[model samples]
Target: MKDASRRVRTEGITGAAVSAVMRDAGLTHGGFYKHFGSKEELLMESLSEAFQEIADRLAQVGEQSKPETAWKAIVKTYLSLEYCDHVEYGCPLPALAPEMARVDKAMKPRIFEELKKYRSRMLPFMPGRRTADKERAFFSIFSTMVGAIEIARMLPEPVMREKVLASARELLLRSF
Candidate 1:
């Protein structure tokens, strides 16, 4: 499952070959169906696992400091070059979102559920006196962070990429 998560995120769900993933996992390509009903099932499960990994990391950040401080740390770590480079093991939201949007109907609900869980994990750290306001803030910050990382990853130059990351991190931190 972990290998699948990494493969799908790094190579993309549609782009990754099932045979290659099976080989990486030390299994025969034919054995894939023994575990997953279909490619969509594998993708949905892999996405769920990736979301859990990210949620765990975010929870740790929230636990390590005050809400605002934790938010800063998360923003810094999330937008860093290391995170951007490590798409396989890092956050799947930025890595898989574009592809997921066009994925099968069966996969969309699973992705949506995982995203809701991810947002719920971050809600406590967001700034808002009301639940609705907090939800709004969380989405705003989360979208900006994800979008910034996605854009940063697209740039061909290292300096430009760093600028985008640093600027986004600065702007987000300042807003909170």
Candidate 2:
């Protein structure tokens, strides 16, 4: 499952070759079904694990620091070039969004549930007095973070990539 998570994040879920996935896992191609019932099932499980891992990391950051400091750390880490360069081991959202959009319809709700939990976990870190205001801020910060990383990763020039990350990080922090 961990191998699949890495593969699907670095390679798209449907784009990754099953044979390569098996090879990475040190198993024969035919051995796949011995573990998962189907490819979709494997993808779902992999995504779930990836999301849970990121959530745990964010939760740990929140627990270890003051809310404002934790929020800054999470944002800085999320927007860092190191995280952008290591999609296979980093957060799955930006890496998988395009592919996840086209995945089996049944898979989406499960992914959405995880996303909801993630946002709820992030809510306390955002600054807003009202629930609705905080919810809006959460979406804005979260979406900007994900979109900035995605756009930064797509840039061919290193300078342009850093500029995007720096700009988005500045804007997000200022908004809060």
Candidate 3:
């Protein structure tokens, strides 16, 4: 499942071949069915796992941080150079959301559910006085972070990528 999560984040769904996935998992390609009914099932389940993994990590950060600094910590961590370079271990949004639109229609709801769950998990860490404020902040912060990461991933130079992350980070830090 970890192998599939990394593959889908870095390679996209269609590129995650059963043979390659099985090979990476140190199992025979023919044994794929012993785990998943189909590649779609594997991909969806892996996506869920990816969301859960990142959310849990961020929740831990939120839990450990003071309320006033929680949002800052989460944003800094999200917009850092390390997170920018490591999509395999990063959020599913910037890593896989684009490809998600191209996935089967039936799977869209499941994807949405995972997204909602992720948002809720991270909600407590956002800096806001009210739930409404936090919810609005959620859309702004996450959308900007996702866009920044996606743009940074496209850049060839580390400096340029850092600029993108920094720009978004600064703007968000001030606004939020």
Per-residue lDDT tens digits for candidate 2, residues 1-176, read 67877888889887888777667666675688887777777777778778877778777776787865777777887888877778898788899888888878888898898788778877776667787887998788878989999999999987888899999999988878
Clashing pairs in 1: none
Each candidate: RMSD to true structure? 1.6, 2.1, 1.4
List residue ranges in candidate 2 displaced over 4 A.
23-31
What does the lDDT come to for candidate 2? 0.81
Ranked by TM-score from best down, the candidates are 3, 1, 2
6-54: candidate 1 lDDT, tens digit per residue: 8888999888887876676566767787877887777787888888888
* Distance from true location, Cα of 132 in model 3, Å: 1.9
The TM-score that candidate 2 achieves is 0.87
Score every model by TM-score: 0.91, 0.87, 0.93
True-vs-predicted CA distance for residue 17, candidate 3, Å: 1.4
Cα lDDT tens digits, model 3, 1-176, are: 78778877888777777777666666575677887788787788889889988898888887788988898889998999999999899998998877898888988998899989999998888889999999999999999999999999999999999999999999999996
CA shift of 176, model 1, Å: 2.4
